[model samples]
Target: MEMSIKSDAVPASDKGFYKLSWTQRIGFGSGDLAQNLIYQTISMYLLFFYTNVYGLDPGVAAIMFLIVRIVDVIWDPLVGTFVDKHDPKLGKYRAYLILGGVPLTGFAILCFWNGFSGSLLYAYITYVGLSMCYTLVNVPYGALNASLTRDTNEITILTSVRMFMANVGGLAVGMGLPIVVKLFDPSETSDLSSSDSAWFITMTIYGLVGLALLIFCFTQCRERVVMDKSETENVKVSDLWLEFVRNKPLRILAFFFITAFAMMAIGNSAGAYYINYNLSGTAGELSIFMGLGSIPAFIFMPMIPAIKRKVGKKGMFYIFLITAIIGMAMLYVISMVDSLKEHMMLVYIAQFVKSTGVIVATGYMWALVPEVISYGEYTHGRRISGIVNALTGIFYKAGMALGGVVPGLVLAFVDFNKDAAQQTPFAQQGILWLVAVIPAILLLLAMFIISKYDLDDERIDQINKEIEMKHNNQ
Candidate 1:
C-alpha cells in the first residue's frame, strides 16, 4: 500500500517531530494509571478472588481467564482498524478514553460483585465485556504514544512518566488494596480473602477512580501526528496482521511484549498465593510483598534514559533480564530452605531484589512500542499506530493467558485445597515455582527475544529524521 501526501495536508508546524509540555506528558501518563487501576487489579487479584472469595474452582477460574484472552484475540484488531479508519471530533485515539472507559469501569465493578458468585455465566459475561472494553481504550491509548512526538529522548521521558504513574496504580492495588479490603470487611476477625463484600466495595472504589483518571487523560492529550481522513479511509482490519508480517521490529517487539507481560502476569497472579500458602504470611505481609513489586519502579524508571545511554537497549535488556533471573533463583532457593522459611526478613529482601529486576526490565519494554511504530511508518509511508499496537496487544494478552492458565493448572495439578489452613507440601512447591521458577524461565526467553530487536536508539532516530525529511519534501 502507498500513501499520497497532499500539499495542504501538512500543517506549517507539523515537522513530524513534536515536543510536548510537562502537563501533556503527565496527562498521557494518567491513562496508563487509569488502566492499571482497573486492569492490573484484575490481573493481580482476580484469580485469587475467583477461587477463594467467589468460590470458583481454580481450574474453572483459569478457563475463564483463557476465554477472556481468546476474546481479546478477536476483538483487539477490530478496535485497531476502527480507530485508525475514523477520526472522531474528540480525537482519533483520545476519544476512546471516555467512550471505552465508562463501560470498562462498570464491567470492572461487576467483575468483582459476588451477587451471582460462582455462576460461570455471570463470570464469563462480566469478564468478556470488561476485556473488550479494555481493548477499546488500550489500543488507542497505545497509539497515542506514537502520536505525541518522534523525539526518542522525549518518548523515553514520556514513557518514564507513564510507567511511574502506572506503577503508582500498581502500588495502590498491590499495597493499599489488601489493607482497604480488610478495613471494609464487616467481620473484624475474618480474613479479607474470604469476604465477598470487601472485594465488591474495593472494586467499586477503584473503578470510579479509574474513570476519573481516564477523563483526566482525555483532557490532557492531543493527537498531532496522524494520517489525514483520506489516508485513514484506506486502513483495513487486515492491516493488523499485514503490518505484523511486514514489520520486523514490530514482530520482535510483539513477541517481547508477550514474554514480558506473561512473566509479569504469572508473577503478579501467583504472588498472593505464594505468600499465603508458601510463606504462611499474613495479609500485611502479602501487601508488602506485592507492593515491593512496584516500589522499585519509582527509583529505577527515572534513570532509564541514562541507563540506556550507557548500555544501549540490547545491553540494558541483557543486564536486567539476567538480574531478574538471578533474583528468581534466589527466591526459589530461599523458599526451599526450611531454616530460611521462618526468616521473613530474608524473604522480603529477596522479593525486593526480584521486584527491582522485574519492574525495571518490563517497564522499559513499553518505550519500544513507539519506536516500532515509527519504523513501520517509515517503511509503509503511513502511520498505522493502532494496527501495530493491536498486534502487540494480542501477543501481550497471549502472555497473560499463559500467566492465568499456568498458575490455576499448577494449583489444580498439585491438589491445592483453597479452604485448607495449610496446603500440602506439593501445593506449596507449585506456588513456589509459579512465583520463581516459571517466571524466571519466561524472563530468559524475554532476554533472547529482545536481543533480536535491532532498532537501537540511534537507528530509530535516523529513521525518524529521514521520515520527517520525506514529509517536508512532499
Candidate 2:
C-alpha cells in the first residue's frame, strides 16, 4: 500500500534510523527472551509454586495476585511519568535494562527461594518487589518502541521480532520447566511435592539466565527518535489521568490488550491442572502442553503482517476468535467425555489449535502499540511513548491479574485437595473449566472489544503524514 506521509516532515536521516541493523535486531529481541524467563516464569508458575512449594492455600495466593495488580495500578502511571519527565544520563528507556533490571532479576530469584515456608509475608513482599522493578523496565521498554522512527513497515518488522523472541522465551519457560525439573529429579510426582532442593535449584538457574538477558537487552537497545533537549519536562499527574480520556486509540488498545493477555494467562495457568488431574496425564504430558503453546507462535505469528494486510486487523480478530472458541469447545468436550477420557492427545490437539489462534492474535497486538503512540503524537504534539506504554502496561498487568486470580479462585471454590494424590471428579471438572471455558469467554470478550478498534491502515498512514508535517514545520 502506498503511504502519503509528508516526506519533508521525516528527515532523510530519520528514515535510515527507522530500520535496525542485524545486530540491533538480535539485541532488541533479547529483552523478551529475558522477560520470558522472569515475567513468564512468574505468571506460569507462581500459583503452582505457592500451592505446591510455598504452602499458601490457593485462596490466599489468589488474593495476593489481585493485590499486586492493584499495586501496579498505582505504579504504572507514575513510572511512565517519571521516565517521561527525566532525561537519564545513560538513555531514555534503554538504561533501565541495568538500572531496574538488576533488582528485578535479584527479586525474581528470591521469589522462588523456599527459605520462608508458609510465609505469606515473604511471598507478598518478594513478588511485589519483583513486579515493581519489572514495571520500571517494561514501561520504558514499551515506550522505546515509539522512540524509534515512524515507519509503519519497520515498526511492524520490529514488533514481529520482539514478539517472536517473547514467544520463544515463553516456549522455553513452558516446555523447559518440566525438563529443568527432570534434570534435577526425574522421578518427582508433582513439582509441588518434589524435594524442595529441586525447585529452588531450578529457579536459581532460570533467575541467573534472566539477569544475563536483561543486561544484553539494555546494552543493545537505544532510543533513536528522542525528544528535543529544549522540550519541557514538566508533567502534571493530572495529565496521565487525562491521557486516557483524550486518547481514544490508547483506550481501545489498552482494553484489547487486557482482555487478550488475560485470556492467554488464564488459559495457560490452568492447563497443567487440567492435564494432571482431569486428563490423568503424567509429567511427560507437560512437555506436550508446553510444546502446543509455543509451536503455534512459530506456525502462526509469522503470518501476522500478511494476515493483517489481507483481512485487515479487525477482520483477522473475528476469524481467530472463532477459531479459538471452537478449539476450546472441543477441549472441554473431550475432557468431559467418558470414552475419550484417556485420550489426552485430542485435548492437546485442541490446545494446539486454540493456541494457534491466540498466539497470533495476542502476539500481533504488540505491533499495534507504536501506531497508537504515533496517533498520540499526531493529536497531542508531545511524543510521550513512556506514558502510552505505562497505560498499556497497567492493562497488561490487569490481564495477568485475571489470569492469576481466576484459576486460584476456581481451585479454591472447588476446595481443591492439592495434597491428595488424585483429585475428585468435581475438582477435575473445575480444572477443565479453568483451562478451557473461562479463557474462551475472555477471548470472546477481547474479540468483541477489538471490533471497536478503529485504527485502519489508511487512517494510520494519515496520522504518520500529519506527524511528519508537524516535525517538518518545527
Candidate 3:
C-alpha cells in the first residue's frame, strides 16, 4: 500500500517540516497539563484516598488498582484504533480533548466522592470509568505531538514544553492539594482520612479546571502529519500488537515506560504515608515534601535542551538516574541515623536531589515516544500514531499496575492500619521501602532499559526525511 500526503491539507511552508508557534505549542501542551491536573491527583493521592478517606483496606485497594489496570490492558488499544481510524469533525486527534475530557472530568470528581463511602462496587464503577475516559484522552493527546510536525528539534521542544507544563500541574496537586483540602474540610484534625467532603470538593474544582484546559488545547492543536484517510481506514486493534512485535525500539521504549512510570507511581503513592508515619510530619510539611518532588522541574526542565546537547541523550539519562539513586540513599541513611532525623533541611535536600533525577529522567522519556512512532512509519509505510501510543500506554500502565500492587501488598504484609493514628515500626519500614529502596531499584532498571533504545536524534531525523521524500515522489 502507498501512503499519500494531502497536498492541500498543510501549507507549503509546513510541507517538508512543520513548525508551530509559541501559542500552538503551549496550546498543545495544555492537554498534558490538563490530564496531569486530573490524573496526577489520582496517581499521587487516589491510593491514599481509598485507604484513608474512602475507607478501603490497603490490600483490597491494591487488588482494585490491579483490576483497574487489567481493564486498561483491554481498553487502551481499542481507544487507540478508534482514534487512528476516525477523523472527527472537530479535529482528528484533538477532538478527544473535548469528547473524552468531559466524562473524564466527571468521573475524576466522582472518584473522590464519599456518598458511597466504603462500597467496593461504587469504587469499581467510578475508578473503572475514570480509567477508561483517561485512556480516551491520553492516547490521542500523545499522538498529537507526532501529528503536529516532523521536525525533530520541534518535537523535542514540544516535549520539553509539554513536560514543563505537566510538572506545573504536578506541583499544584502535590503542594496545593493538601492545603486546599484543608481549607474545605471542617475538621481541625491533621489526618486526611476524616475529610471526605474536602477531597470531593477539591477534586470537583480540579476536574472543572482540567476540562477547561482540554478545551483550550482542542482549540490550539491541528493535525498536520497524520496518516492519509485510506491508510488510516485499514488500522486495527491487532495492529497495536503487530506494531509492538515488529518495532524493536518501540518494544524497548515500552519497557522503559513501565519502569519509569512504575518508579514514579510507587514513589508518589508512598510520599504522604512516609511523611505522616515515618517522619511524624504535619499536613503543612507533607505539602512541602510532596511539592519538592516537582519543584526541580522548574529549575532543570528549562536546561533540558542544553543538557541533551552537552551530555547527549544517553549520557543525560545516566547522570540523572544516578543522581536519583544517590538521593534515595541519603533518605535511607538519614532515616536510620538518630542525629539526622531531626534536621528537616537535610530531608528536604535529599528530596530535591532525588526529584531532580526522577523529573529529568522520566520527563525526557516522552520525547522518545515520537521517535519510535517515526520508526514505525519509516518501516511500515503508515503513521499509526494512536496505535503506537496505545501500545506504550499498555506497558506504562503495566508498570503502574506493579506500582499499585507492590505498596498495598507490602503494607498488608506489615499489617498497615488506617484507623490508628501512628503505624508500627514494621509498617513505617514498609513505607520507607516504597518511597526509597523500591523506586531506586526501578530507576536502575529504567537506566538499563533506556540503554537498549537504538533510535538517536540523528537516526530519527533521517527516517522523517526519507518518509517525506517517499510522499513527495508519490
Candidate 4:
C-alpha cells in the first residue's frame, strides 16, 4: 500500500494520466500489432493455405478445424488459470510478450509451411501449438489492459491507440499478403509450388516483423495498478469460475467476444475461396478485396471517441452493427445476382462498407474489459485481472474456433476441391455464402446478444468512483 501511494496528494503521474509516454503507448499497442500479424494472417489466409497449399481435403480440413476448437475449450481456461497464478520475475504479464510470443511467431510460419503433404498430423501439430502459444500471450495481454491503469479515460485512450495499431496491422495483411503471395505465384500453373513458396515467404516476413514488435512491447509496457501484492493465496480455478458467475458485465462481455470474433474469423478465412472461385479474380484482385475490408478503419476509427460520446457505447453498437448487417445483406444479394458489374469491384465496395461498421463496433468492445474489471473490483474488493481476462479470452478463442470449424464444414459439405483449378458451381456458391451470408447472419446474432449488455456510461463512472474511494480509504 505504501509503494502504491507516494502521498495523499495525487502524483503528477496520476494527474497526467491521460498522456502516457510514446514508448509506453507504442509498447502496449505493439503487442496487439504483433498479434494481428500472426493471428490476422491465420484468420485471413489459413483456409487457403490448408486446402490449396497444404493439400487437405475440404471435409477433412473442416473436421480438423472443429477438433481444434474443441481442444481450445480445454486450453483457454488452463492458460487463464496459469496466467492468473504465476508472477514471473521478468514482468508479470509482459514476460509472455517474449516467451509465448516468440514461439507463436515460429509456429505461425510453420503453419504456412507446405511440407508434410497435408498430413492430418501436420495440420494438428502446427495449428494446435500456435493456438496454445497464442493463449499464453493473449490471456496475459488481456490482463495487461486492466493492469495499465484504473482511470476510465486512460483506458479509453489506450484502447484507441491499440485498436488503431491493430487496424494498421490488419491493413497490412489484408492488402499486403496477396501482393506478396503473387510475387511467388507468378504463373497460373495448376500446382501449389508457387502458392506454397508464396505462403512460406509471406509468413516468414510477417512472423519476423511480429517478433520485432514483441521485443518492443516487452521494452515499453509496465503494470501500474496491479493488485498482486494483496494476494493471500494464488488465484485458483474456482475463483475464475466464481468471477464469471457473479459478474454480470463479465458474462455479457464474454458472450459478446465469442459472437463478434466468430463473425470476423468466418468471413476473413473465406476470402481467398470466395474471390477465387466466385468472381474468379487474380491474386492482385484478391489483395484489393482484403485491403478494402480494413481500409475503413483508418478513415473511421479516429471518430470513435466522438461516436461513443455522441451516441453512447451501447447505442453506437446498435447503430453500427445494424448498418453492418445491411452491408452484408447487400453483398449476399450481389453474390446471387447474375448481371452485376465486375464482381470484384462490387465486392470491394461491400467489404469497404461492411468493414466501416464492423471495424469500429467490434474494436470498441475491447475497451469494455477494463470497465467490467472495475465493476468486479467495486463489487468484490479484488482486482484479479487474469481471472477476469481469462473469461473474455475463452469467448474470443471460442469465436475463432467457430469461425474455423463452420466455414470448413460448410465447404466440405459443398465438396470443395483444392486440387482442381476451379470449383464446382455449387461449391463456389457455398464459398460465397461462407464469406457473405453466414458471417452476416452471425453479425446479426451478435447484435441481438449485445443488445442485452447493460454496462453504460452511468454504471462505468459509478464503478470507477467506488474503486477510487476504496484505494483512497486504504
Which has the greatest lDDT?
Answer: 3
Order the candidate numbers by TM-score, best to worst.
3, 1, 2, 4
Q: Once superposed on the true structure, which residue ranges of model 2 sit more than 4 Å away at CA?
A: 1-11, 15-17, 190-193
List residue ranges in candidate 1 displaced over 4 A. Answer: 1-13, 190-192
In model 1, which residue pairs have backbone atoms overlapping below 3 Å? Answer: none
Q: Which residue ranges in model 4 land beyond 4 Å of their true spot?
A: 1-18, 186-194, 341-343
Of 3 and 4, the candidate ahead on TM-score is 3
Kindly indicate the candidate among 1 and 4 with the higher TM-score.
1
346-427: candidate 4 lDDT, tens digit per residue = 7778888888888888998999998888888888887778777877887887898888888888888888877667788899
lDDT of 4 at 41: 87
Q: Each candidate's TM vs. the true structure?
A: 0.96, 0.95, 0.97, 0.94
Candidate 4 C-alpha error for residue 332, in Å: 1.3
lDDT of 3 at 235: 95
In lDDT terms, how accurate is model 4? Answer: 0.80
Candidate 2 CA-lDDT value: 0.80
lDDT of 1 by residue, 56-144 (tens): 99999888889889999999999889999998889999999999999999999999999997899999999999999999999999999
